[model samples]
Target: MSGCVFCRIVAGSVPSFQVVGEPSGVAFLDSRPVFRGHVLVVPRPHLETLTDLPEADLAGYFGLVRRVAAAVESGLDAGGTFVAMNNRVSQSVPHLHTHVVPRTKGDGLRGFFWPRTRYDDDGQAATYAARIGAAVAPPTRG
Candidate 1:
């Protein structure tokens, strides 16, 4: 973690366009942005990927992500936002970071979600969503 660039940024060893900094993590503007006013939210502790981050820290990490997303939408007057986090694949940096990019109408990002596929039917889509919802539901104590 010592040599990681994101850790350096968090340590104040490197300059960054910081937006939000908390005990859990820091949200800063991406140096190489897909669009202007793009922000990257990174955990303070050096977690290489989503699976690497402890479950206890997920809430804090995602809290910053939500805040930064809202800021990107309101501050940039964007129509929407494209929030994403690439793991090992296509991940420029080794540290885990979420990209919250502001989106406008007709930005020509139609192909961003390449290889798009649709559900076989509405029922299939609903079933998938419901399965995911159930998977995330809090465990009930016996």
Candidate 2:
């Protein structure tokens, strides 16, 4: 954790473009943003991947992500939000974090992430959402 950049940032050993700093986690503007108002939210304690994060911390970590997402949406007046996280493979940092990117319609964000597929219809979309929702465990009390 000591040599990890995120951990160093959380420890105040490294300077970051901090947006919000909370006991639960820290939110900061991405130094290399895909677009304007790109933010990253990271847990205070070092975690290498999503699976490494403790269940007890999910609510608070996700609460911070939600808060940052709202800020990205409202602050930039974006049409919507793009929230994502990579695991061990594409993850540049070994720490657990989430990317909250402000998105606008027709912004020309192409293939690497754009052109999202839509469900065949509302029913199919609902089914997929429900399936993932059903697997979600309720947040445990801290």
Candidate 3:
């Protein structure tokens, strides 16, 4: 956590193009922008992954992300938005964070376009969404 770059940003040891800074979280423009108005939202506390974060912190972190997304949408006139986060195996910073990207029609950002069998109908898509949603539901205790 001490050596982590995001931690340093949160600690004010490093400079960032910060957009929003709150007691629970911070939002900043991404140096490596996937699209214009790209932002990164992170909790103040050091956390390696979403599972490592306390529920309250995680909620507050995403709440900030949503707020940033809204700002980007209105300011940039983006047609859509992409929100993402990578865990240990795919993370670059080794710290928990979310990416809020303002997407346009021809952004050239192809997400998860793996070759796969096509779904037969809307039922298949609905079923897939429902299952994934249930699996990712927040802990009942939290």
Candidate 4:
């Protein structure tokens, strides 16, 4: 946890293009995005993979993921979204982060071979973050 970058991001030590932060998890724009509005949702505490997440926390964590997926589609005016998680293989951060990528028709995203991209500048990343942040629904009171 001390050296994990995602933990630092959740702790607000690292500056990130944050979209949403909840009791369940925090969502932010991926610096190396597969698409313009690509977002990564990670648990507040350090968890290396999906299986590492506690069962009691699943609903809260995934509930946030669900909202972000929808927000990515609506905020970016995309047709749909691609939601995925990697355990160990290709798990860039070793944190239990879910990727919610905006998708549209004829986008040419062939398969697992994701073509990565970046924002022209920090302002562009912030703009995308704001859009998704605005579109994310408030957490339900239960």
Q: What C-alpha RMSD separates each model from the true structure?
A: 13.5, 12.2, 13.3, 0.7
Q: List, residue by residue over 1-142, the lDDT tens digit for candidate 2.
A: 8889999988888876676777778876666667655678999998889898899988889987886776666555678878999998879898988987668898888645634333455454344333322332333455
Q: What TM-score, over all chains together, does every model reach? A: 0.77, 0.77, 0.75, 0.98
Ranking by lDDT: 4, 1, 2, 3
Candidate 1 off by > 4 Å: 113-142
lDDT of each: 0.72, 0.72, 0.68, 0.95
What's the C-alpha lDDT at position 82 in model 3? 87
Candidate 3, residues 1-142, lDDT tens digits: the string is 7788998998889876666677768776666666545678898888888898887576666767776776667656778788888898768798888887777897677874312233445454344323322322222333
- Per-residue CA lDDT of model 4 for 1-142, tens digit only, reads 8799999999999999999999999999999999999999999999998888999999999999999998998899999999999999999899999999999999989889899998999999999999999999987879
Residue 61 local lDDT, model 3: 68
Q: Per-residue CA lDDT of candidate 1, range 1-142, in tens? A: 7889999999999976677677768877666667666678899999899999999987877876876777677665779999998999989899999988778898766756522234455454444333322322222233
Clashing pairs in 3: none
What lDDT is reached at residue 110 by model 2?
68
**TM-score head-to-head 2 vs 3, winner:** 2
Which runs in model 3 stand beyond 4 Å of their true positions?
Answer: 112-142
Worst lDDT window (10 residues) for model 3? 132-141
- The best candidate by lDDT is 4
